[model samples]
Target chain A: MSPSERHNVTVHGPADGQPMMFAHGFGCDQAMWRFVWPAFSDEYRVVLFDHVGYGGSDAAAFDRHRHATLDGYAADVLAICDELALDDVVFVGHSVSAMIGVLAAAARPERFARLVLVGPSPRYLDDEGYVGGFSEEDIADLLESLESNYLGWSSTMAPVIMGNPERPELARELTNSFCRTDPEIAAAFARATFLADNRQDLERVRTPALVLQASDDAIAPRPVGEFVHDRLPDSRLVLLSATGHCPNLSAPEETVAAIKTYLAR
Target chain B: MTIPAALLDESAEDLFETAPCGYLTTAVDGRFLRVNRTFEEMAGREREDLLGKRRFQDLLTVGGRIYHETHLAPLLRMQGSVREIAVDLVRPDGSRLPALVNSVLRYDEAGRPAVIRTTVFDATDRRRYEQELLHARRREQEVALELQRSLLAGALTEGEGLELGVAYHPADKGLEVGGDWYDAFWLVPEETIAVVVGDVVGRGLAAAATMGQLRSALRALASTGFEPGALLEALSEFSRRHELGQMATVAYAEIDVRLGLMRYACAGHPPPVVVEPAKPARLASDGRSPPLDAYSFWTDRPDASLQLPPGGMVVFYSDGLIERSDRPLQAGLDELLASVDELRDARPDTVASSLAQAAAGTTGSPDDVCVLALRRRPART
Candidate 1:
């Protein structure tokens, strides 16, 4: 499970530098992370790997329950630690895995030095006195979309969610890979994720956290970004003026610079 | 009978050309948008011939035209999108095409209605597969539910003196149904009625079938005129003879209203409770018997009896009623008694509902349970 074996880990400068792990979003494997890693790997032991079911990883290891929520993914991060035997790691997770690092860091506070949650969501749906920006019905529609023609839905919906029509092919390809991940596993994960109320877990995160949000991200809007920053005790909010879900793909130089500055701070 | 390769190739081309799918797009107001080359071919018209001039509703067969104007159009207008929506489409020659269509709201840069992009899957093959899958699921549920419905509830014979009300609730957790059964029928001639409550381990169809077998034996053996002690021992032997896999918790009681005595047998079953006006009520008879299974290996104990003295309600419950995770069974039983006390003099049905709520309070999930309440009526002069 070491980042070196399965994932495309391109180190720009030093391998023995401080360790930082790069987690990819759904529909993408480690490659979704490639553009940003080259800039960060120079100053750190940059780690990257495909999630259990995606990319070059063994597909049989993926199951309905295992990848259903973030716990199993957090466990994968931990397994990477035990395999690489790295210590005092800086965890960087994107999309679903971003919140996963938050959980893992919260659960085992000692393993992580700091959390740089890129486009994280503690909860997706808004409630009374709480704002996550989606309605119950909206969430239901999203789930229905995922269930019906999951590949086409994700391919088509990613661009809509990202609001970057210029990268329609990118959105389609990302979604196609995302949809290729076992649907049953993804659906169960969707239930575990979209149905979860992790507001309590957010309050328990003690690590110094950084929230990197793309400016016009259809998925993670600005208010939700502010919400994550406000809830975290030791945190700062950095809004990249990028108009896509994965800013590392759309605006890598600014995203990399922001990450390097946040790590330095 | 020799078909040339060239002709076979032509047939394949025709098959592909006449494929069932007819792709189309429409404006938000349900006007004719764009039909694929195949779709225009299916309609026996040129693409230009069908474009712009036709409304989607107009292309529907007569029934479909009315259906879209009523149900489909209204819903899509309000809901913004509809999926797997079944409908029929009309061809230009006044023919109909059976299809399943899904549509979504497409908006212009002004966020106004732009066009509705629809992917219509020809339902002819898929409809059949989907129907078959649904039929199979329905059949499984039916067989399981039938087994649930027919298993022992209450057994009553003519001229019986005892009155019994029973409730059996399977765990609603959706895995498999546990086998919980009760019978309150009579023993003829002596004017005595027998009450039996038991839980067979495991669940689903097998446990249900085992329930049927055990309950039938209980009914047949009640007429043996033997004491409750001997009755259950014979029942255990009957279970052993059948080689039923799982064990059961059972209590069998014979009530004689005129005599006011209840002879009861316990096969590792929870003791029956009595709600009395005197002290905080207690379980009437506490005799114990081993569970009925091959590995039970315990010796038979004597049958116990108590006077169902006038105006008392005797409560017999299965083990699932008293089962709990952290609390002792006695504590769970106490909770049940307290809950029953809260709903004083509740009807048998109300009592069942209250008991169910009480059980829910113990754990997040429901376990199998069967409760039998037999009230002893006051005797006349």
Candidate 2:
């Protein structure tokens, strides 16, 4: 399948404008950027997509061996860029997707003009001297709890979760289309996201990066964000007062301003 | 009888404190604004300790916090409400209380998200029951897997002037044991080797058991000198009598290595392919009959014979090798013929594995695939 079909790529803004790709984190799909991407649509070619096994992306495209590590997802990012022939692109990634952008830009440095890493953490488990803000047991609890919490999500809920936004009346019937994912795929992605350690990979990225750190991100805390900024070759950190992991949703004005400010530089 | 005015006045307050479920209100960012007495008691903390001091997430394990920040919080923002979310509440004593939570985001007049009203239900017993059910399901899957593996465990037959290779891949979607199976063994050592591929009617433990019985019946009947066609006839009778593997499809072939002779029959199965060096692969489409125990007018089955050339290859496979939901069965058959011809120069093992992998690489087949390739050794100088 074409990468666009496999990843469910959607495009907006002027086709001739420079591409600005927005990738959502682990929980939600491209809809996570509904409030943020529109800010760039006036001046940039906005690209939005869901990762495989999440949102509108084809779940059947999920291959266990290929997606076992972050590299597989990174390959998909590169594929999407190549297919669209996007260069000097502005890639905005949130939560786990921040590291996915890192791996992609590191592999194809020339394709990306700037990397925006929001609430990014290279590792989640606390190790020797560094604190990733979570213990191994905490992650185990998370996965176990995820197993027990799939009551509201089933096969019937999938189409609603992946409902078309153009039809507002249909979309209005259920508010559940936001973060629900296939239970098996969700567990697999949870393992891939929480158990990853991309600290060594951060140094490989030569492209300039803007790190958007939240004031109280329980998932990717301050120290973790600092670690990401410090490890990157050329990066700047902007701490936002938004109190959650999702600043784009909680503090969009400030998030948009931060990116605009970074791009102006 | 008229109710007392004093009792009537306290009823609303009494219900909040003594309700069966806990109730709380939290700021949009999840900090607790107020918590009812039931919530206070369930949390094992006083109201002063919880209200304004702790966020609802603070009471949960760290995992729940991640889930809340990543899944729950975002869901609340988009949908304006979430229900039956499972989280564990940590008490002052460090003990965990499994709870089910539901929350609705309330908006102020200007449409800004205001406080979140939530209800918490104790799920200690429910969690235990869920775990038990999951454990039982996993146990059954494991049992079915173990049975399938043990039944298909024996090595394929190998001898002088004969090279045999077999590859089997179970469906990737689930852990249930599928109905496809392959077997290769010497019906008469050093003379004739019997190769069979079959697909039974259903899945899971019953299908695996049926496959095992059919394989045993085929092996036992083949040893007693039943030809390819007669063997299928006897097997159909056995299936009818035992009510096992009814309507199953099988391809049975016997090759005489020294003589370079082959006989085969397909019972409602995909035709086997024969590959000769520098010659396009062709299907052995002559000998065909209805599936086992199928209601049919034709009683007697026919066996087809072919004089095998040195270095020639013959393949026995289940329908999975030549069937896909996205394309016609004929297309898959054509692809099989083309792939077999391309791999004719390779070893039997390579040919078998490559074919299985190619079929599996596409939108994966829901059914398991089995391929058994047998090639006679090239003529010696």
Clash pairs, candidate 1, are: A27-A178, A68-A189, B60-B90, B61-B90, B155-B184, B155-B185
lDDT of 2 by residue, B99-205 (tens): 99999999999988899999999999999998999899888888888888999997777899899888888875556888888898887798888889999999898
Least accurate 10 contiguous residues by lDDT in model 2 chain B: B358-367
What are the clashing pairs of model 2?
A: none
DockQ of each: 0.02, 0.58
- lDDT by residue (A1-265, candidate 2, tens digit) is 6889878799999999999999999888888888899999999999998898776677767766667788889988999999999999999999999999999998999999999999999999999999998888999999987888774466576556545523534534555556656677778888899999999999999999999999988999899999999999999999999899999988888999999999999
Say what the RMSD of model 2 is. 2.9
Give one digit per residue, the lDDT tens place, for model 1 in B176-213: 67778877775645457787888888777888888888
TM-score of each model, in listed order: 0.46, 0.92
Q: Which candidate should be chosen as best, given lDDT against the real structure?
A: 2
